[model samples]
Structure formats: C-alpha cells, structure tokens
Target: MVAPPDNDVLRASALHFQHHDGSPALQGVSLGVREGEVLAVTGPRGSGKTSLLRCLAGLDRPQRGEVWFDGVAVHTLGALARARLRRHRFGWIDPVPVLVPELTVWENAALPLMLRGTGRRRARRAALEWLERLDVDGRARSRPHELRHSERQRVCIARALTVVPSVLFADEPTAPLHRAESAQVLRTLTAAARSHGVTVVLACAGPRRAGLADRTVTLLDGRRVRTLHLPPVAGPAGPAEGAEPAGSAGTEGRPACSLSA
Candidate 1:
C-alpha cells in the first residue's frame, strides 16, 4: 500500500463504494486533508459528498481503495476499532439536528464526553462553554423539542465542538439555518476549530457555503472534477438577459479549472 503525504492527517486514494442496491456513491475519488486545515468538499446533490465524508470518517467502509488517518490504515480496521476511533478522535454533524428528547440541551452536548468516561461536572462545563460560544447557552436547560429548528442545530454544533475532536466532519452543518444564522454558525465553528488546531472536513452543496475553507475539492457524479466559474454574459436581449456557466466553480483564492464531470 502507498503511504500518504507526511502532512496529510487524512487521506483517501482511488475510493470506490456503492449502496446496497448497487447505486454508485464514490468512483475513484481521492484526496488528502492537511493537519489543522479546513477542507471543503463541494458538489451538487447526489454527487457523493456525504459518501466521501462517511468513508473518511470510518462510518462506512469503501468497497475498494483505502482510507488513512495519522498514517494508520482506517480501511483495514475492524468495526469496533473504527467505532472507538470515532468516539475518541472525531466529531460529526449531520444535515439535521439529532438529540435525545429527554435530555436537556447541555446534557445532550455533554453526552459524548460522558460516554468517553469524563466526569459529569467536567463534561457539563465543557459543553456549556461550547454552547455559549455557539450562542445557544440560554437554551442549556431546555429540551430539544423546546427549541426552534435553528436553535437545535446550534446545539448540535456545540455538542460536536465540546469534544474538540481531531477531525470534525460536518455534512451540510448549516442546512437547517437561515442565511444569517448559517454565516454565524460557520464562523464560530471554523474559528473554534482553528483556535484548537482541529482539522475540519466540511461538505456543502455549493461554493457560497464553502468559502470559509482554506481549500476546496469538488465532486461530480461520484468523481473529482475541476470546476470553473465563467462570468455571466449578456444574451440576445437588451440589458436583462445573461448566461452563466452550467457547471459549478471553486471559490476565489483557490485552484480553478474548467468543469469536467
């Protein structure tokens, strides 16, 4: 097996995976994430962003290829070993907010630490700190069902951050929030990760949402692509018509290339 770069904390090479029903999810996709870097994986729906993150996070094993973390072969690890790694070294945020209905907000946020054998008081302290940073501390005593959708999502973000994981996998983390709320949460998440020297792998559907990352890699049809943003051109109409490229584009200050699906 080939070794990943010395700088890459996580790496996937020529991965291939399919759903149980035989639907392709990732096709020969390969990428590397550097230590403490926020890497955004952007693509349209059904383009395999979630699948790629899942494979890298060890939530699912690819049918082919390999995943590596800190020079260890993640793809070769047993299911229980992967679970232990995730609980201790990684954090995850899904598109939707998921919390225990019976647990208070702070309790939910502290759950990971408690599960890992931390003292309840210490875990609660850490969880409350994160919730305050995410602007959700006021809801600490409330239940999940008592908060708005956006509030609940913020709690989820806080929960993920309380662990200060080595690599945080956020799959459309701001999906449930309004544009304003999304920006705030992203800023907090990215800033916290940076301050703590955490590597982040964030997945989003488009470029606008991926701007905070230091670098970005896009996927299309379960494969890597070089997407270009062509300026909109005026069409055959007076001042009101324009044409934009049909393909997606990378954010400014990063690599750019023509879209090739």
Candidate 2:
C-alpha cells in the first residue's frame, strides 16, 4: 500500500473543457480532494462529471485552466509526463469499463503492475492478494468471460488499485450491481483507500450507493453546484438558550446553486 500523502493529491481550480461543437463540457469547476478523503461526483449524464474526472486524471487536457495533483501541475506537463504521473499516482476507472476477455481474473488484475515493471510471476502473486482482500480470490484463474458482469467490474477495480496509487479517479465506479454488492464494494474501496491514505474521486449517478462517501457534490451545465449544506454552528451563547434550533435550515445534501439546463 502507498503511504499517506503529506498534502493534497488532487486539486483543481476553474477548469473548463469543451465538446466538439464549441459547447462547454465543463465550466469553472473547482474542487479539492485531500489524501484519504472520498468525494463523490454526481450528476446527470453529460453534466460534466466524466469530463471533470478525465481532466483531473490527465486523460483529456482541459482547454482552459489548470489541474494539479500532488503539487504537480498536470495541465502543464507533456503527454509522457502525464502518462508517467498517471501510472505512478493515479488509478482511473473507465466509464464504459474495459477488460481483456482472454485474460484470467488474476492476469487482468496483475497486468497493471506488470506493465509498471513488476515481473509477471510476482505481479500474479500480488494480484491474488488484492483479490483476496476484495473477497474474490476464488475466481483467480477465471477469465473475464467466465465471470458475471459485476465480478468483472470488481476485477477491473482491483487491477486499477494493484499499484497502490496515491489518488484513484473512479468514473462510474459502481454500475449494474445489486444494493448489497454495491455497498460491499464501496465499503471495500473507502476502507482500503483510508489504510493507504489514497484519495478516491468517484463519479456516479443516483444517491451514491448508500454508505459510499464522506461528501457528495453535483455538477450542472458544466460547473460545481455546492451540493452539501453544513448547518450554522451553534453559537457559544447556545442559540439563545432555546428556540426550535431551525427545523429545515440544515438539510444535508441539497445543491447551493441551480443551472438552467
């Protein structure tokens, strides 16, 4: 497992990336995830959620503004530099999902480490350990086609984390799973990340699979709409000693701003 970062592993300020028609895909999105923090990005399809995650992972460079990871300005780096950073520090789970159907579960999970210079035998061994932690070790030699869809997804995740990245960028990390399995996956992800002090920026739609994150934020028409409302802290005077304490003044997960489309 990777050690905790002494500082922020991922931070971005006012990032703007556009689509082919000159339409904005993401606009003025600013958010920060500290090491060991899990933040969920939720929005409708094309609400800039995937784009935002891609920009942060350096898969797609933003047209304007900058993205920084672990104090390194990713937007300023060249292709090779970005790739190196991604390999060493970032684990990006694709939105559509990708896995080699011919490779066994162990091979698929260990491929990342092998590509990073771990010998195949050693990679396979370490990969089995990851599968054990994810509770799928019994499927070690099973190929992708032999497993169920949810199992494949979890294997892909294990592959992503095989290298113990400092920051994991998970786009649609949870998909097509029953509630029980989804919660199990989320529990595993956060617990594993916290142990290694890895920050997880997972993008998904819906209520975020029950017990998934410490905070959740929304994106609308290409910008972050503060989706968390913290209550006014109690005054030292103790809210004038009585008062109903404001009933609905402090709901938890509503957006601070709204966008027209």
Candidate number achieving the greatest lDDT relative to the actual structure: 1
| TM-score of candidate 1 on Cα atoms, chains taken together | 0.89
What's the distance in Å from true for residue 139, model 2? 1.6
User: lDDT tens string, model 2, 7-60?
Assistant: 666777789899778978988887778778888887656678889988999988
lDDT of 1 by residue, 1-261 (tens): 667656899999899999999999999998999999999999877889999999999999999999999978999999999999999999999999999999999999999999999999999999999999999999999999999999999999999999999999999999999998898899999999999999999999889888899998988778887764433434576223443334554533222334443
**Candidate 1, which segments miss by more than 4 Å at Cα?**
228-261
Per-residue error (Å), model 1, residue 158:
0.5
The residue-level lDDT of candidate 1 at 145 comes to 98
